[model samples]
Target: MKFDVVIGNPPYNKGMDLDFVDLGYKISNKYTVMITPAKWQTTADDYSGCASKNINYKQFREMYVPHMSYVCFYPQSMEVFDIYQIDGNYREY
Candidate 1:
């Protein structure tokens, strides 16, 4: 099946967020929207302590960024969701 839009709030663990975004973009014909941690925007080397370190962020950025129409960020202090905070050593990511 094909879709015109793909939207999701994927888990923020182990770089799964980017995986979702990638899949979304692949399947969607018009738009792919994801609610994920903002860490993927930074250099992969910055994720040395987490699974995201393995992601080639440079390639991801080059491929996806140009196609993105809009992007948003919320401050760390702001609670975007009412759910409990994720537990991990790399909370920032």
Candidate 2:
């Protein structure tokens, strides 16, 4: 299937742990900063990160929203404590 515009209300929380051990995956970089927020509090290791408490937001952003042509969706409430604006440009739920 082909997609053009995508939108959704993403949950707000911490992050997730990624299985990069046997996946043979490579991000091509080390210092990557990613920002993940969900309603439920989850450990950063749940998605993609080096530590269970620290989530690799940069890797998450690259793996999830790596392209600029994609329309990202996100909830407004997540922006409450955030230092940046919640304007829609990339990365949704």
Candidate 3:
């Protein structure tokens, strides 16, 4: 059975990563949209800065997880941003 509406208070725990979830949402529904933590959607080369040089929203949206419908969370502080942004690069390995 398919429901017409769905709802929930999705978690944003420290250990939780929203990238996989965001991609799932996009692939699950062509009309779906969400305001996720800015970092997960777009960040610098080392996963730093306001806007990333490598990572992008399009990449996040490309993840394939059909069960994920929506997301709710807040961005990490600028201090955390500092950790990711080193020497003008986002170094996520």
Candidate 4:
């Protein structure tokens, strides 16, 4: 089946967040809205040791970034989820 939009708050473990965005777009006809760590944007090329190891973030960026319409970032310290804390070393998104 196909969809007009795909929205999700995918798990953050093992780079599943990136997977959701990748697959979400494939199944959606219009948009894929996902809540993923903002860190991915800057550390795109650094997931060589994780589950996203096979993903070429450089090429991913080149393909999908231009189509993005909006993005919002909240500091990891802000505890947006109030479930866990992410390292605040990289604060700018």
Candidate 5:
């Protein structure tokens, strides 16, 4: 499914990696709003979406809060790509 805007809270907490959920929302490149931990900033390198050295990505904006969740806005253009996580989950990022 294609979309211009995406807004929602994916499954968070309970040992969920917010980055995975963020990447899952790759279907919406123009804009995305998600309430999640700010931990995703440090995991940018871990995302397969950054595999290409030439890909330019804008830093995600979020209100930094550890224990408390923060809403994040990622208004960046990304080339849709696919990868198979070792856990057998297929994702498009």
Candidate 6:
């Protein structure tokens, strides 16, 4: 079995590994989009920088990692974010 398009609204919370989201891209033939939790909230990474209580957008963007080629909110101050198709993938499709 194969898929031309794969879409998912994955369950997310603190300390959740997003490896499954990567699977969506691996299986899809064309496109895959994952709507993850807002960057403002603290995630598993615990990377220092984002001070959400102060409404620090710059810090949030700076701390965001393991994602590139993504569609991000401009002047992104507490906005919804999603990762787009990256140049290379974790696995061949």
The full ranking of all candidates by TM-score, starting with the best, is 4, 1, 6, 5, 3, 2
lDDT of 4 by residue, 1-93 (tens): 889989998876656566778888889999889888765677657456446644556656777788799988776535565454645233333
Q: Which digits, one per residue and each the tens of the lDDT, describe model 3 over residues 43-81? A: 433432223333344454454324345554544435443
lDDT of each: 0.70, 0.35, 0.39, 0.70, 0.43, 0.46
> After TM-score superposition, what is the CA distance of residue 24 in candidate 6 from its true location, in Å?
0.5
Taking every candidate in turn, the Cα RMSD to the unseen true structure, in Å, is 4.4, 11.8, 10.6, 5.0, 12.6, 13.8
Candidate 6, 30-81: lDDT as tens digits: 7667665454344334454432343243333453343435655443322333
Off by over 4 Å in 3: 1-9, 14-17, 48-58, 61-93
Expressed as tens digits, the lDDT of each residue in 1-93 for candidate 1 is 769989998877767677778888889989888987777787564444444443456656878889988988875524665444445333332
Rank candidates, lDDT, best first.
4, 1, 6, 5, 3, 2
Flag clash pairs in model 5. Answer: none
- The C-alpha stretches of model 6 lying farther than 4 A from their native spots are 15-17, 38-70, 74-93
Against the true structure, candidate 1 reaches a TM-score of 0.73
Question: Which regions of candidate 4 fall more than 4 Å away from where they truly are?
Answer: 44-47, 77-79, 86-93
Question: Which of candidates 4 and 5 reaches a greater lDDT?
Answer: 4
Once model 3 is optimally superposed onto the true structure by TM-score, how far is the C-alpha of residue 10 displaced, in angstroms? Answer: 3.9
lDDT of 2 by residue, 1-93 (tens): 222322222323323333321121234222222223431223333444234243264544456444333333455644544334454234435
On TM-score, the leading prediction is 4
lDDT for model 4: 0.70
Compare candidates 2 and 6 on TM-score and give the better one.
Answer: 6
Tens-digit per-residue lDDT, 21-41, candidate 5: 445456775666655434355
